[model samples]
Target: MMTRIKYRFLPFLLVIILFVSTLTAPVSYSVQEPIMPDSEEARKILEDSLSIVEIDHEIERITARQQELEVTQRQLRERITVLEERIDERRDRADAVLRAYYMGERDHLLVMLLSAQSLSGFFRILDFYDMIIQNDQQVLQSYNQQYRELQASRASAERNAAELAQVKDSLLQQRERVLALQQQVDGALNTSGNPEAMRALIHEFTLYWENVGLYEVKRHFQALASAMENLPGFIQGSKNILSTNGKVYTINIHEDDLNGFLRSEDKLFETFAFRFEDGKVIASGESGNLSLLIEGRYSVVDEPQNAIMFEVERLVFNRLELPDTTRRSLQDEFDMNFYPKQLISFLKATEVSSSDQRLIVRMELDL
Candidate 1:
């Protein structure tokens, strides 16, 4: 019975020993670590980043050039606008002057003179007559002067417009070139793996830059040529005429008065006018005699005899002396005339010598 009891207690003792061993045993657990994505995907990400950086650099370069072009274009446009405004102003002034001259607003002077009734008034009338004459002269002078100035301003505006057009055209071409370059760059970026595309893009950029350089060179040459062509005229025209000690060499008055003076009237008449100084005319005569040559030919004032005759090529009004009765009516009509100071100066500089029977004047012509 004692052996049987010990066997039963042995089971309980073994259970107790197993529980104690379990409690004393070191516990270990394995946790599986997740595998990272492939390096190729990461390399692609890095390549994309590099591509973006390259694209950003190209974009910056393009933006800088675009800004520069924009500024240049703006300046050119402003200059053209300013020139246009000036032309408009000058043209308006010319129109007003011409209208005033045509309307006989200058006749107001005669009215003022005639209105004077007393002896003092009569004296005042005489004084007014002189004043009116002076004013008439001034008006004609002003009108001619303004007309010439208007012509000059118009010419300048035309030049500026042409320059602006050329600039705009060039800018457009440059923009196209830049756009083409950008497209190439974009294509290369899209095909980053393709070496040939990248090389072609770089070549395109080089060619675009070269073209830009050539455009700049051409612009410089054109500007130089324009300056050279206009500078001499400006210098000669701007000289002081009052300081020169010379007599008026030519006095060409247009007959029609409407067409004004032209440079192509006739060589003989034009040359004679160019040579005849202010004091050279010992006698002056005008003939209304109209003659019909052979059949359908028409001639005015027979081909002047031995006397060197010059046909008035252009009539430049230096002064006007209107009748006292019509002065008031024409007052406002004549203004802003252009006096060809340079031409006048050239005429004044001519030297004249009188022979026994004829007067000879030396004149110079600009080619």
Candidate 2:
């Protein structure tokens, strides 16, 4: 009996050990990978993103135009009010002149000329009467001309107001059309029945593009700064002066030649630095005038020269790279036919300040 019980207990113990071993064994499962920006799916997504950005900008422009039209309309109304007041005043003046002349004065002038005491006095009185009549005629003519001008101005103002109203209506229609396009883009992106997901991806892409583009731009500036460091160093106790407008300006003195002029010790840039975001480029830095002057060894006595506002924006635009298809999509979507035009639009959208020896640049663009 004891031996049978031991064998039965051993089998139960073996079964329990087998179940524990199964639990301890590692299990493998598959996970979905993130979609790469270079993938075809990403390309389609980017296209949609581009359309969205374009539509957003279009809406902004249309809204601005509408506001501008409203401003014009208000101005026209104000002008009409002023003209109406002037017309009323002019009419009253003309009425007064007509009443005074017709009711009071023709016989009086004749009587005064007849009462002259001498031949010379009589001639002088006659000339004065003639001049008075001529002046009255001129006043009437001036009133008539002013009335005509008022009528013309009123007509022009009315026409302009009407045109502006029509233009505003057209802008509203355009805004609707833009909204329709945005809806279409939404529809396309939501084909997977998860618009939120698509939007999330777009958001991610925006962040990714901004980060990558910023990195690249920062790198470019770093490279430029490094290259600029090789420029001729300012010597200690040297009179580093620049001249413009026939006035000489002294450069700030530094301890050693390695502390180059023009913001050399500033991180990643001596002349300028930049960042990209939101389809705009902002640049703020010291002008390259000092570098050019120093490089060329230009003389102060030569001529009064204007400070050259550096075209650093051109460099920022040129250095930026996007796939050819992406560029074409930008052109079609935003009507940005040229890279420089796109850069300009972006710059207009961004705010920048580059005064008092500091450089700051911020640029934005659709990736």
Candidate 3:
């Protein structure tokens, strides 16, 4: 009987143990954390973020200029209105004066002078008629002068209007560019973890671009664009410039190009010679027995948008790869962001690529 009872209780104990185990089971979540992008993709995303920052700066500048144009245009318009009103009033007075003199006589001044009754009275009437004629001429002269001033004022107003229109168009274009950049950035960041850190890194690299590298390149491109306006003189008689249809142009740049372009700029890049090989940008330099090599990879990124970017991958000094901290510090200090916005504004870059011993940008001819 006891054995039977123990077996019966054993089944109950098993049931209780199973219940306990079920209650104590570990919990698991079905959703997974977002993973960061691969290094190459992340670098492209960084470039896009930097583009956003550049677009924001452009928008801010355009907005300020737009405001100035608006104010100037308003003031000019007011001046034009005042001038017009003044011209009209002056014309009315001149017309009244002329009408009173001419219609009062309804004949030549000679007739009026000859119609005097006595010789003495005729002389006096002649003097009075001469005085009226002189006054009428003065009125006409004053009216003409005022009318000329009105024309000048109107012309100024028209010039202001034209400039304002152009400014507005520029502002609109910049705003559109910023929107596109932001959308690209948003899409990129959504797939990325630690958005703030990514943004900070991008901002830091942008500072590098602005302060350290390509500053001269940017200024020269801006000046050239401004000087040319609609003229495509940049490619004329230039060996570095290549174009087939004059609508699409390619320019291969190298150490010589940079050296010529920089022309005595005190930058670390001056000592380096750059070349492309197997989709990588390699720079080698030496200074007083110290040798350095910087390698970057170039790729066409298409997720956020179709764009080409160069990202620094390795830094070797004296034939040894530098530690990560030193590499990162140097990269932040001397990141070579090669997107020339001024040049792009004139000739839109269609494709940017790299190959063995050559880095080339294929661009639409002009704006």
Candidate 4:
């Protein structure tokens, strides 16, 4: 009995040991590091890769849109051409009918009626007169129908041509935008010197622009507020900045002031107010010699809760001709390689002042 018990207990003990060994076997296996190196160079390389990927993706989307627009425009043009050809054919037919009438084709019918001899002949002439009248009426009706059709076709063709023109214009504008964006990416990539570094910077910049939406702006503001909660200076500044509706922070820096703001160099941040109509900026105010510029345009849409959105239509630069040194410094600081256009439909405002001049800044922030 003791030997039988010992055999069974020995088998159970062996099974437990096997189970424990199986569990510990995985732990004993050698661990390998990830393929990517944990260093700045690797990070930079990864970032660069991401940037290129984003640019490629954007280019693909834009190309696809362009192709679609081209196809649509081509189709519209073809339709218009067909309509125009039909109209031309109808016009030719109408012109032929008018020419026949003008050439005295009706005089021959009148002479036939006068040549009737007896009562039977007169009856036959009357029947023949009705036939001539019917024939002439039919021709006139057909001419009128063709003329109306030609007019309709011409109108349709004109409309189609106009539509095609619009599509072509839009396609050209989109292509220009794509080229500009591509150039920007290329410039950023080339400036880094290192291909990997360039890629990384591009990726970072792309990501920065991509995520800058209304929701992201609120999150950023919240994070900033949280970070400054315990700071003594921030706490003091926050109290003064708080307003009933929102907050107002004044920057007394000469560069920040609208009156002395260098419009030429700081065109990107100029105080050109927009006139909003039906949620679109229809016009922009021009700057004069006077420093104070007031825009009395009312908001088309109801104000959004917890946020304000402004559309930038124009940029007004300061008229002051600065010294060469100062001008160069301003240009360098503001990255003033491109001049801000008056018809800036793309620029959105992220911040604004409450003053009558309403000094607004178009920032990457969504607000």
| Top candidate when judged by lDDT against the true structure | 3
Question: lDDT of each structure?
Answer: 0.39, 0.48, 0.61, 0.42
Taking the tens digit of each residue's C-alpha lDDT, what string does model 3 give over 75-149? 877877887888888889898987876686535667867887899988987888788778878888988998888
- What's the CA RMSD for each of the models? 38.7, 21.1, 24.0, 19.4
What is the C-alpha lDDT profile of model 1 across 1-367, one tens digit per residue? Answer: 9999999899899999999999999532232212222445333333333333333444454456556656665665666566666656665655665676689765676776677778798787788678856765666666566556656656665665666566556456545554654565565456667556445544443343234322322332233233334422442444331223243333222222111121133221221221223333221111121111100111112122111222212211101111221221122222111223333333322333433333333333322
TM-score to native of every candidate shown: 0.25, 0.40, 0.46, 0.32
Name the top TM-score candidate.
Answer: 3
lDDT score, candidate 2: 0.48
**lDDT for each residue of candidate 2 in 1-367, tens digit (9 for 90 to 100):** 9999999899899999999999988532232212444556545655556445544555576577667767776876777677777777777867777887789867788998999999999999899989978877777787788778777767777876777777677667656665765676666776755667777777765554454433434444454445443332332234542112322222322213323433455543454533333433344344321111110011111113221122222322212223323322232333211121122322211223333332222223322
Ranking by TM-score: 3, 2, 4, 1
- lDDT ranking of the models: 3, 2, 4, 1
Worst 10 residues of 2 by lDDT: 290-299
Better of 1 and 4 by TM-score: 4
Instruction: Identify the superior model by lDDT, candidate 1 or candidate 4.
Output: 4
Model 4 lDDT tens row, 111-152: 867887787987898898788667667666765665676566
Off by over 4 Å in 2: 1-45, 95-117, 127-131, 134-138, 141-145, 193-197, 204-367
